[model samples]
Target: MEPLSAEEIRRSFVNSTKSQVKSMALPAKFTELPWESLDFLGWRDAKAPNRGYLVVRRDGGVTGIAVSTQASGAARRFAGLCDLCNTAHHVSDVALFAARRAGTAGREGNTVGMYICADLACSLYIRGLKELDVPQGETAAPEVRADRLTTRLESFVQRVLA
Candidate 1:
């Protein structure tokens, strides 16, 4: 993934209103982020804990969406995998989230929900930066996992826009 400027990130949003983008906060370590190491940028909104954001470069343009974090869906300490990156986490670190559809459908209350990392840091989790107890015997290499992350995330974004 390439480094994205604040302007680019703001323009990337597909599922959020312009005002949402304008008011949204960047991750706390935005300046120190290692952009070259990212498969996509994702973070829980600081000012609005229930809100989250994801951004990626797709087909020559930047694309992004707003996600709403609901409470944890799993009752056990460790349960399901994050739908995007397939990383296992303590149930408390994984939560249900939804993205409103991109247009009038969203205005009509349409949203797509799934379980994802509580911090929205699938990129770091995959690379071992934010460690989680991954299940044993998963054999895909890091590069392969990164590719899958981007592909899966794009698919989710498409669902929001579709």
Candidate 2:
């Protein structure tokens, strides 16, 4: 992923209105993100407890989406697997986040939700930069896992735009 500027990010959102984009908050470490290791940029908003954001460059432009955390419940008692990285995380560290679809579909209240890491650090997780308790005996090579993570994330983003 390429390093992005605030203006570029603000103009990238597909579902948010002009006002919403203007009011949206960037991630806490927005200016210092590890862009080289990421397939997409995502984070749980620092100030908005239940809000999240994701952005990726595609089709010659950037596309961004806002996400909201679903209410926690008994379902959260069990470990959850992130759909994007296929990583298992502690139930408390996994969140059901939903993004409104792009364009007209969004205006109709269409949204897509999936279990994801609460910290939105799946990129680092797949790259072995984050410590996980999972066994590594059957794991694929770092490059392979990274490629798969990128592909999976792109597919998820496509669904949001579609």
Candidate 3:
């Protein structure tokens, strides 16, 4: 994935009324992040913690989402297995972070996940894919299906930030 410029990021988030394109602060150690490991365009925020970053792609059009490693104390009442990989996250592996669509609809602060390596693609990896091997006692609804999981997470992130 190619790195995105600040202008590209700002333009992508034109629809997000609530989201602002500010520099992210990243931890100094995070400088070693493997950009090549990502599938979509990703970048670390220079002004904020190094853990702060953004990922962008053309889901239908130019859709960009922001991500941060900062954790929230909000308790998790909702428990469900990942629809894609079928892994159990005990509400911890699954966290509610903030995000927003990068276009006209970008004002929404959606919630997303972090530390989701079970599926390997962060949000999408944990969300079940066709090849995923779901574990026993783990079930997901159509609304929480793998494909929709990422989008749902994004919405959750928006709510948290908002």
| C-alpha lDDT of all candidate models, in order | 0.84, 0.80, 0.43
| Residue range 10-88, candidate 3, lDDT tens digits | 6654323334454433324444544444344333455643234444454444455555555434646545454323455
How many clashing residue pairs are found in candidate 2?
0
Winning model by TM-score: 1
Worst 10 residues of 3 by lDDT: 125-134
lDDT digits (tens) for residues 93-150 of candidate 1: 7878899998899999999987888888888877878766646345788788888988
**Which candidate, 1 or 3, would have the higher TM-score against the true structure?**
1
Quote the lDDT for 59 in model 2. Answer: 78
Name the lDDT value of residue 31 in candidate 3.
46
State the local distance difference test value for candidate 3.
0.43
Report the Cα lDDT for residue 29, model 2.
67
TM-score to native of every candidate shown:
0.91, 0.88, 0.40
Going through the candidates in order, what is the number of backbone clashes in each? 0, 0, 34
TM-score computed on alpha carbons, candidate 3: 0.40
